[model samples]
Each structure stands twice: as C-alpha cells, then as structure tokens.
Target: MIRSMTGYGKGEALSEQGRCTVEIRSVNHRYGEISVRMPRAFMALENEVKKALACTLKRGKIDAYVQWEEAGGCAALPAADLVLARGYAELLRSLSQELGLKEEPSLGLILAQKGVLGEAVAGQPDPDQCLAQLMSAVQGAVAAMDAMRRREGDALLCDLASRRGQVAQWVQRISERAPQVVDEYRQKLKIRLDQLLEGTEMDAARLAQEVALMADRCDVTEELVRLSSHFTQFDDALAADEPVGRKLDFLMQEMNREINTIGSKSSDAEVTSLVIRIKAEMEKMREQVQNVE
Candidate 1:
C-alpha cells in the first residue's frame, strides 16, 4: 500500500515500576534516516529501535523520543554517609591544629565533599523489563504512525488521479489540434509564395516539397505518443503495492521533457498554451510524488 513520508504517532505503556512514553515524528526525505533519544541507560537499545522502525517504514527522516516517569510508590529516598562526613571533619581539624590556622570548617563545607553522600536518590531500572516495555511502546507508536501515513497517502493518490486526468485531456486536445496547425502553415506558405512570385513562373513540385518539409519539422505525433505512454506508466506505478516514489518522479521528468519539446517545435499559439497547462500539472504532480513511498 502507498504511504506518505510525513506523520506523527505516540504511545505509552504503564508498569508497576513506572510509565514509559514513546513518540515518533517523520518528514519527507530522499532516504531512510532514523534518530532516537532515550535515557542514557537505554542507549544499548538504539540498534533494536532502528530494526523495529525499518520493518515498517521504507523512507523518511524519522525522530523518536522516549520518556520514563516513576510513580510515587516507586520513588527512591536519598541518604547521607555520616561516617564519611565525620572522618573528613576529624582530618580537617587535625590539619588546622598542625598548621596553627585555629579555624573550624562549617558543617555544610564538610558534607559537600565527595563520597560524603551515599548513592543518588533514583536507582537503576531492571534492564530486561525496561527493554520489554520500551519495545511495546515503540510497537504501538509505529502502528499509529503507519495509519497516519496511509491516510495521507490516500489523499495524495486522489490528487494525482485528478492531475493525471487533466494531463490526458490536454494531450487529447493537442492531438486534435496538431493536424490543423500543419494545414494552417501550408496555406500561409502558399499565400506568401504567390505574392513573392507574382510576375514569375512558380514550380509546383518545389512548392509541394517545401510544404512537406515544413509539416515534418512541426510534427508532434512522436512526442505525443511517447507522452501518452509515460502517462500510462505513471498510473500503473501509482497503483503498485510497493514503494513507487522514485519511479513516479523519474516518469514525471520524462513527461515534462516531452511536453517541453512539443512546445518548442509547435509554433502555434494554441498548442503552446496547451503545453503550458500540461507542464503546470506535471509540476504539481512532481511535488506530490516527493511525499510518496
């Protein structure tokens, strides 16, 4: 199924120890790029997160963030090391008496020394359980993100279909007007030649040859035929189940090239206007294709 490169999803999982939240945001990119942010202890799981994301997404610049919050019941309390604090105070007092400084250090100054405090309040989480919870949250977030991508993809498909129809309409109009352009050129050439050779004899064969050459030079049948073929391929790629963004982009380039050539070769004002309209639709289609995967 088609998927858009832009979307957002968030998921949370609660446990007796804490609650974990995962949020993912993605934007259009030429290739797959994943960035993850989580607790320092969970850094080991970065490879796992990238593997999980790769299973579902094909292309985008994706950012994933994870947060963990501990409930009241799971909070840890801080404690000071009184023995270490006393040892430091005794050592400082002995040094002061030996140096004859006659000064006593403040309680706050003694407690501020390193190792005078026990371990930090918060303890390390159970690595295995935390990994499981993180995986679950990430899975849920990925599912939600896929849904949003699919929804946006549906809208893009509709827009592309409408633009494709417009391009087909313009191609038909150009085809119908092609023969008329040749006829008009032939008539104009005949009129000019008659005026230039008014008092001289004109060669019928030479005039016919000149008209045929001019018609050949202005012929857009080959370009129109190739353009129609490219349009068909574009539609087929859209209906495909796999990633078709790159394929569609290449087809759009080819289609635009053909349209530009037709405009340059066909001197008729009407044909030029039709080419302009087709090019405008092609540009819009190109922009939309950038978000497809």
Candidate 2:
C-alpha cells in the first residue's frame, strides 16, 4: 500500500538492565535520509537503528531518538578513587605549606579533583544483551509509524482520484468543443465576405478549402488522445502496491503538456476555460504527489 512521508511513532522496552525508549519523526524529502541520537554507550548501535528505520520508511527526513533509563536496582553507583583523593590532598597540602597559607586543604577540594569519583565501569549494561530489546522497540515504532502513513496515503489517494476524474471530464468537454470551433469560424468568415462583397456570390470550393485549412491548423485530437493515455497511467499508478510518487509526478507533467497544447490550438473561449480548469487541478495533484511514498 502507498504511504505518506510524514508521521510520528514511539516504542519502549524494559529489561533487567534498563528501559529503552525510541521515538521516530519523519517528514517529506526527495531522498531517504536517517539520523539517530542516543547515549555514547550505545553509539555502536547507531547503524543498526538506521538500517531498521530505512527498511520500512523508504523516503523521508527521518530522525530517531533513543533514551535509556537504568532499572532502579541496576543503576550504576558512583565509586570514589581513594588513592587519587589521597594524592590530591597531599599535593594541595604541599602547595599550601610552600605558599605559607594559613587554611588547610578541605576534603571537598580533594573530592572535587578530576577522576576522584566516577561511574563504575563494571556496572554498564552489555550491548549484546540489549540488542534484542532495542530491535523489538524499533519494530514497534516502525509499525506505528507505518500505520499512520498508510492512513494519510488513503486520504491522498481519494483526493487524487476525485481530481483526476474531474480533469478527465474537462478533457472530454474540450474534445467535444474542438470540432464546433472550426465550424463557427467558417460561418463567421463567410458572413464577413458577403458583407464586404455587397451580394457578390462566393466560391464554394474556395470557402471549403479555407475551412479545411482552419480545421487542420486547430486540430487537438492527438493531444487529447495522449492526455487520455496519461490519465489511464495515473490511475494504474494510484492502484499500485509500491511507491509511485515519482511516477505520478511525471504523469502530471505529461498531462500539463497536453493541456497546454490544446489551449494554444483553440481560439474558442469554452475550450480555453476548460484547459485552465484542468491545469489548476493538475497543480493540486502535483503538490499532493510530493507527499506520496
């Protein structure tokens, strides 16, 4: 099924080590681009996260945010380096004595030194163990996002279908009006010639020749035929199972080309009006196609 390129989704997983939450946001883009943001500890999994997203969300500016909260009991405890703290205290005392300072080095000063207290390395969760939970959460978020995109796509499909049908009707109107334009022009020409000649008889063969020339000059049969073919292709694209945004966009361009040709060939007001309306509808469909995937 088709999908829109804009959506939001979130998923979470809980384990003995921690809770992992993932949120994904996507917007329309011409190409597929994915970015991931996570803690430094999980940097190794960034590629995995992007791969997972790209597998489902094929075209968009996608951003994924990952948050990890260690379980209450699993949280890493800060460990004090007693040896480093002692060394800092000794250095401070020696500097104080050398400078003839009256105040002693406080315990706070020693503990505040760099590397004195830090998170225990052993307390960190294993990345291998966390992969399963992370992937599960990723899959959930993708499913949610896909559902939203599909719903939006359905709405797009309906709107496009309605506009396509309306354009086809106008094309039909133009085709019906084309033949009358030449006949009307012939009548107007003959009347003008009669008025100028003051009752002189007109040449029937010459008049027929002139009308034939006019009809040949203003013929839009070929353009209308191509437009009909483009409409059929547009319908097929909408019913397609895969991404057809580019295909639909190309068809819109082709339709516009045919409509422009029709407008230029005819001098009739009704045909020109129909051409204008068809162009307007094509613009709307073109804009909507940019969001399809």
Which model scores highest in lDDT? Answer: 2
lDDT of 2 by residue, 38-122 (tens): 8777889999999999889888899999878787755457899999998998899999999999788998888789999986643
The model with the greatest TM-score is 2
Q: Which run of 10 residues does model 1 get worst, by summed lDDT?
A: 119-128
Candidate 2 minimal-lDDT segment of 10 residues = 119-128
Q: Give each prediction's root-mean-square deviation over alpha carbons.
A: 3.4, 2.9
- Candidate 1 per-residue lDDT, tens place, 1-293, comes to 57799999998888887888899999999989999998777788888988898899889999999887775545666678989899999999999999999889779889889989776565556656688888899999999999999999999999999999999999999999999988888788888988998968778899889878988988998998998899889989888887888888899999999999999898899999999999988899999999997
What TM-score does structure 2 among the candidates reach?
0.87
Native-vs-model 1 lDDT? 0.88
Q: What's model 1's lDDT at 237?
A: 88
